[model samples]
Target: MIDSVKTPRSTYRQEQADATRVRIADAAQRLFARDGYSATAMEGIAREAGVGTRTVYAVFGAKREILSVICERWLERAGARELAREVLDTVDPVERLRRSAGWLTTLYSTDFDVARVLDAAVDEDAETRELLAAKLRGRNRVMDQMISSVEPELSVPLAEAQSMFRAFAAVGVYGALVVDAGWTPARFESWLADALVHQLMSASAVPDPAHP
Candidate 1:
């Protein structure tokens, strides 16, 4: 006869705590989007989250931390890091740039609300601005690497190619097209694919724009 093993009480408690944190973060995300970060009070977050104010403080030390949690969750949903890997793995120069375009569209499409909220709060607080800047730097670093993977095949210099890639990934471009002009995400992706393939790759490599 063998004895059965059971999960530890502390592990269960940690899981419960993590779930509570997520709930608080999600509630805070909605509130922050509706009310600018400075305007959002901790009590409101606790009330919206259905948790005690103390619990909110215990889980997240400050309101900015909640923003950080929300950004982390958004990145997971957007698959930002994972998709960069896909671009690096792609062998064809055209397909790789196209995947990079798709990655940018996915970044904004999955959580444009958060992006808008962050932009709105950027000037509201110093801490918030730095936090957003750090995230932007991290993402841009990955984009640089993805473009570097195809440097040998690029028609332009590496610096020029990277600059073009970063420009296309700008949130402003996406907002102007999809949010303002009401272009669908798919259309933006298609346009970006054509633009990158034509401008970055050699003429021999530029094929008929693959419409997906």
Candidate 2:
């Protein structure tokens, strides 16, 4: 029946609210990237979104919360959490390692402005630092799980393998290779895949490092 499929009034209202929050978060992210995070204010975000300042305050309450939403949206665009799951789910050792590289490459290429903003945010108050730290811890946990999936097949110890994963996934490598040196995203992905395969996989079990 048509009535059975009708949208609830409450659900519609909630969806509208969520959409407004995303708009504010996205507008704030642009400002944070253009101006430093400390320099970008809630008023600027409201002005950019063409919304009242009160709406932003009502939705996110603080700039830090808006940043948190931006980070989440960025990750969603990167397919990062899903890719991490795929890496762990992969049965082949070579394939698993290669998929991890894909995940890292995807993240670095997916609007790296969030990383730039977070770097600037580190100089902020302790609460903001804690938020960043917590986010890093969550990411590391996922990385550890991905590496652990192929641990016995790795050339290095578990801790060492995880450390390698962390190092190669750093924004510095992406910045240097892709942003500074001007390598294309595909080229950077290829380089990282090869580097990771050589560094982490045993010679006998290794396959071509090209991502699928």
Candidate 3:
């Protein structure tokens, strides 16, 4: 009878490859973040990772793919959607909305690489652009889910919840862009946090007569 257990060779090789790919991408991220995408060459990434140029290309295909990987990493590090969800779990609808907006602004202001990679992704390579779009769509879905969670605590329609979702998204992206607008990192972060908090408070104060 054939053995039921799988061979370890495939699993071991896959794990090894994943480690190598991660190293390459990490190097690419650092290089791309320091030097704009246009200036970061494949050879530089290989040198940084102590890998061959062929290996870098084999792992990421091109510079744009590397950028996408970095962006994905940045988003994951932020615990972004989960943060928004946490706010929605609160019983107070106003607090929930305030926390949601604050969460986004804080995330964007705090994570430098995320802002950098996202800025680079815009109007960049086709692959990177598509990947960024997919990320945004996924993030928007997360926002909508959070909105639905808060609706029970407020007198708002599901449509209004979705509106809040879009509004927060715009605020977050705008916050990210502001980081590049010549403000010191600390100043930008503080101003963004305040701006988003004010917006959230204003939104939450809206009288929804339909309050259950």
Candidate 4:
């Protein structure tokens, strides 16, 4: 019989590495949120994570990579891709728009701090600005996909539909109405659903304008 080698040791090592990555990411997120991206150094992140500075660098390479990981983590935690799948699967145009709004609401509400941190960092860091641009492009792509799903029902031009979708789904709009204006999440969602339906749907699909 051939000698069988155990793989548990390797599995355990991989688990340990994953745990270390989570710890470092958590520490970096805290520092970045509290201190701003530029102010939070790798040394500080390593200290917060209880690891050596070289270890942080070895894992992430640079602070920008750490921030990118944080953004990706936030997106995963917010179920962004899953929500997009759900939106794509829905057949009704109005429902698709509502789901899209819901996705944005969930994302902004759950990761508002990360968004704020990224927004602030963009002005001061070129790397972060590029990251933000990539994120925005991703956002626009999602919007385009969503708009295409309901294109058959829309009366407006595709370009106009996409622009309106992007405007209504903006994070800043949610931040303003919910974060700064003190509106509840449910209220924001309700308003967003109503606004999107009104703005994107054809006149035949929309509620009577005189009814308020």
Task: Please provide TM-scores, in order, for all candidate models, with all chains considered together.
Answer: 0.87, 0.88, 0.65, 0.86
Pairs that clash in candidate 1: none
Candidate 4 per-residue lDDT, tens place, 1-212, comes to: 99898779889899998889889999998988899988888999999999999999999898888888888999999999998999889876778878887887888888788888776776656776788789879878987988878777677888898898888776678779988999998889889888877777787765575985
For model 2 the TM-score comes to 0.88
Expressed as tens digits, the lDDT of each residue in 107-130 for candidate 2 is 878988898787668788888889
What is candidate 1's local distance difference test score? Answer: 0.87
Runs in model 3 deviating more than 4 A are 1-12, 140-212
The candidates, ranked best first by TM-score, are 2, 1, 4, 3
lDDT of 3 by residue, 163-191 (tens): 75576456445545565466554555455
CA lDDT of every candidate: 0.87, 0.86, 0.68, 0.84
What is the alpha-carbon RMSD of candidate 4 to the true structure? 3.6
Q: Which sections of candidate 4 miss by over 4 Å?
A: 1-7, 124-127, 207-212
The regions of model 2 sitting more than 4 angstroms off are 1-12, 207-212
Clashing pairs in 3: none
lDDT comparison, 2 vs 4, better candidate: 2
Ranking by lDDT: 1, 2, 4, 3
Winning candidate number (lDDT): 1
